[model samples]
Target chain A: LAKTTQPISMDSYEGQEVNITCSHNNIATNDYITWYQQFPSQGPRFIIQGYKTKVTNEVASLFIPADRKSSTLSLPRVSLSDTAVYYCLVQGSARQLTFGSGTQLTVLP
Target chain B: EPEVTQTPSHQVTQMGQEVILRCVPISNHLYFYWYRQILGQKVEFLVSFYNNEISEKSEIFDDQFSVERPDGSNFTLKIRSTKLEDSAMYFCASSERADTDTQYFGPGTRLTVL
Candidate 1:
């Protein structure tokens, strides 16, 4: 398991793009970067995952640099409902996934 | 989307009492996991099950904790003795595979141990 560091909190307004970056300096070769979003009183939900380069889905985009030491989760045109805690996890096979304190994203109206 | 479902949205129990939390994972998923979040804390992994056996478990999963897949559709977690520290939101999740598949999580069972 690779330890991850992200901001403690972020503030965004409606219709603006929000990008949250995670730093995993000790990332291993087999580790993959995965992002999850959790609202209060709910389970975490998978947002995006990537091994390298960039991957995009209906909800968000993940950008992994060439070094793979860090990754960014980008959410476009955010809304108030997007307010949640975002977690960045790095792990390989046969390892228990760990979640850090995560970045608390507050989407203001 | 097929999602995991957990029973007893909220459970209140006394100290030293045994409690069982049940979950119904996605129909096609093969890997199951249990995680808990102490209020205002990070989510912690408890255990992962695959092929009718435990693949991984955290230190938090002590002797008091056990997991079982009684039948094809249901997965369960048992706490032999509850403590006040056991109060937290227990989440059940499942993935199609363990390597890179995305895990879908249930709403969670909020256990309050007094």
Candidate 2:
């Protein structure tokens, strides 16, 4: 498993774009980067995942540079409901998954 | 979409007592995992089960903790002797595959030890 570091918190306004970056300098070739969004009192939901380059989904987009040392999660046209803690996880074949403290995104009204 | 479901949304128990947390994962999922989030803390993995046995477990899972899929439709985590620090939100998650598959999580069971 590779360790990841991300911002503790971020502030964004409604209708603005938000990008949360995660750094995993020791990421391995077989490891994949995955992002999950968690609301208060609920379980975390899968947002997007990428191994290399860019992967876009209906909810968000994940961009991974060639170096794979870091990845970014981009959310377009955010709303107040988009406020939640986002987790960046780097996992390999083994099942010993670890989650960081996560970045809490507060969307201002 | 089918989702994982857990029993007794909230449980309150006394210290030194035994408690069981039950969960029903997504029907077709193959791998099952148990995680806990202490108040104001990050979610930590406890154990992962596959093929009727534990595939991996974290250091937090010691002799006091145990997981069992008693039957086809139920997965349970039991703590033989609950302590004050055992109080936390327990989440059950399952995935269709072991690698790179999205693990669906269930609404957690909030356990409060008095």
Candidate 3:
């Protein structure tokens, strides 16, 4: 499993764009970067996933550069309801997904 | 938008007692998993089940812990002898496939052991 490092916390006002970057210097070829958002009392919810380049959905976008060592999760038009912990994980074909200390994103109103 | 569902949103039990956390994964999904997160700590994987057997499990899933898929829709996690440290939010997740498909997590069952 590749170890991922992310900022401990980030703050943004409502309607601002938030970009959270994760670094996995030892990412493997088969590893795909996945992001999950967890609320205070709920299970982590899948946000977006990408292997390389850029992938976008209705909620967010994932940008992976050519290096694959780092990836960014971009959230557009943030709102107070989006305040939660964001986890960036590099997962292979393995059965289990390891969760690291994620970045706590705080969206202020 | 089908989703996983867990029962007994919150459970409180005494140390050394037994507790069972139940979940109903999305229909048509084949893979099931159990994970827990201690308060103020990161989420930790416990085990993954596929084809009526455990495909993978972490050291945290020792003799005291067990998982069962007794029926078509119900997947369960049983703690034989709950300890104080066993108190945490237990989440059940299921994925369409193990290789690369995304896993969907349930709301989670909060277990408090006293």
lDDT of each: 0.94, 0.94, 0.96
Runs of candidate 3 with Cα error greater than 4 angstroms are none
State which candidate has the highest TM-score: 3
The lowest-lDDT stretch of 10 consecutive residues in candidate 2 chain B is: B96-105
- Give a tens-digit lDDT track for model 3, residues B1-114: 999999999999999999999999999999999999999999999999999999999999999999999999999999999999999999999999996678999999999999
Q: TM-score per candidate, in order?
A: 0.98, 0.98, 0.99
Candidate 2 on A1-109: residue-level lDDT in tens? 6899999999999999999999999999899999999998788888898999999999999999999999999999899999999999997887756889999999998
Clashing pairs in 2: none
Clashes of 3: 0
The prediction achieving the highest lDDT against the true structure is: 3
TM-scores for chain B, listed for all candidates: 0.99, 0.98, 0.99
